[model samples]
Target: MTEQQETPPTGVSKALQKDIPQATVARLATYLRVLAVLADEAVAIVSSEELAVAAGVGSAKLRKDLSFLGPNGVRGVGYDVIKLRDRIEDVLGLSEGHRVVLVGAGHLGRALVGYGGFRRRGFAMVGLFDNDPAVIGTSVTGLIVRDVAELTDAVAALEPTIAVITVPDAAAQGVCDLLVAAGLQCVLSFSALALEAPATVEVRRVDLAVEMQLLSFERARNAESAAEEAMSAAAGALLPRVSMTTSKGAVVQP
Candidate 1:
């Protein structure tokens, strides 16, 4: 009997052909951000260990992630930081600028508009919208806020693919509905409440409390490490040092 040839998995094949993992793609985007900062300082090369530390990943994991994008690093040396940065930018679909619209003109909305990271990362804020009449005429980050009544018109005019919601929990669903109606494909929400979105629309939530909890955990770990070091030092001082000479005249300390 003849054996049947095995076909490769489509998703894995496509991802491999693109030379990246879904997870690695996300991390590479983060690494690219850090690399951009280093490149601005004129730094040339960075080792996986250093890059991993900067990107908050294990060195081995970082290497594996980069490997998905093909053999990029030199043995015994390191990766060319700028080259890796550019490669990641191309792979993650950030090489070309993307248009984004902001919903809500509150503090978070204003901060998102004023954020330099999005601009640095190749995202363009083409429009800002709010329901309040006062905020509608106000200027934010050089762009005037328009009324929510103009949401559809503004999105249609700007042709934005991404929408950011910074409204209150109660208004989040309504804002999302308007964004969907405006033809937005993706959303980045800052509201504390979870929102139900259509399968076609991708929503990424940025919860403040989740980040604060992570920070609190980090502080606790650091405090524990310091306490352990202090305890070790005190214990070491209490121990008496004894030296003995063996038959070979080699001295050993106990």
Candidate 2:
């Protein structure tokens, strides 16, 4: 068989493509957030220790993640906050703006549309949709909430590659199906439902209740760990240990 022709990646595909680990990819966004704070505070040259603490990671792991984008750090002097931030943004494809549409103009959807971070982080909210007639034609965050019935047309007109589904669990799957059919390759769903999509599409579920439960679990674990440590310390102190030798290596008991 003759060698098959290699198709070139489209601009958007190129932006989305990266060889980094999913873990690193997740951390990169967090790092970018930390970096943005540093930049805003006019702080230059952040040490690995400082950056890692801010990003909730180890300094060594942070360095490794940065290395995936090639060498962007200066030895000894740490990383230049602004330059590193730019590099990270480019790697995460935040350097280019992404057109995003919100489906399910309920409370969750409305809140997300009003969130300025979406625009600040390079995601442009192009449209909002809902199936409820009461919400349709209503203005939200300066944009009118269109009926979900218009999703197909909106997708054709707006060409959104990303969609956010904040519909209820009962409606999430259908909304997701519509989104995928309408050619949205990436989706973020706030519903509690487990969404199924084609292999070509990516679906991320963000259940607020689940997240809150996870937070509660973590807090409980932390509290238990702290209590265990305190108990151990108290037990150790009460053991009545005999004092030994000092710097002179002489044996003594107190």
Candidate 3:
């Protein structure tokens, strides 16, 4: 959604993509998110360079990534923000709203239900389910929690294309089994454990703890790096900050 800054100097032929690489496909999702933000901010045309910067990718790589969408952006004038966004939507199958159902009303489940991101991204949370009697009739984020035993029936009736699993590790497989049989083709699993689904079904696992641990590792690396830099600086400070070179320079410290 960002405005175009500068035009490309050379004329270019229309780019083509027979099949997008998985890496590029992954990056396109990120691009879509950035485009949405830019569109919300009222950005119109965005040069490849600008979009790349915003998306944390190289300009050439971003341009190549977008080429998979086919002739969406003009080489010189840049891309029309809305047009590019729509193209990505078409590619991602987000042009149509996808119905979703939540399984498990645990803490993580409750959070996913309340999250507005799915709705914002053309995914609608149509139903909520949990097994516990205490939570069965309770409402989280305006949807009444139905008993998990009703999942198969609920899926048949609700016809949700996406099923979200936030149950504990012990229950994830059971929940997954129900979802596959209930005719849901896609699942978003938040449990720490991996759930095995049929080859026909697609399951996207999101382990929050693993992600946090990765961040922790990164932080530790950065701290170690900083400590190394500080030690180097402290050692350097013990020596001369500047040095002078005579006519026949001995590289003498001034």
lDDT of 1 by residue, 23-62 (tens): 6667777788779989999989999888888877778877
After superposing all C-alphas onto the true structure, candidate 3 shows an RMSD in angstroms of: 10.9
Specify the poorest-scoring 10-residue window by lDDT in model 2.
245-254
Ranking by TM-score: 2, 3, 1
- Every candidate's CA RMSD: 10.4, 10.5, 10.9
lDDT of each: 0.78, 0.79, 0.78
Model 1, position 79, has a per-residue lDDT of 88
139-252, model 3: which lDDT tens digit per residue?
Answer: 898899998888888888899988999888898999999899888899999887878988999999987677677667666766775676688798875444244222222111
Question: What TM-scores do the predictions have?
Answer: 0.76, 0.80, 0.78
Using TM-score as the measure, the top candidate is: 2
Poorly placed runs, candidate 1 (over 4 Å): 1-14, 17-26, 41-45, 53-58, 221-254
lDDT of 2 by residue, 93-113 (tens): 677779999998877888899
lDDT order, best first, reads 2, 3, 1
- Model 2 clashing residue pairs (backbone): none
Model 3 scores a TM of 0.78
The true-versus-predicted C-alpha distance at residue 22 of model 1, in Å, is 6.7
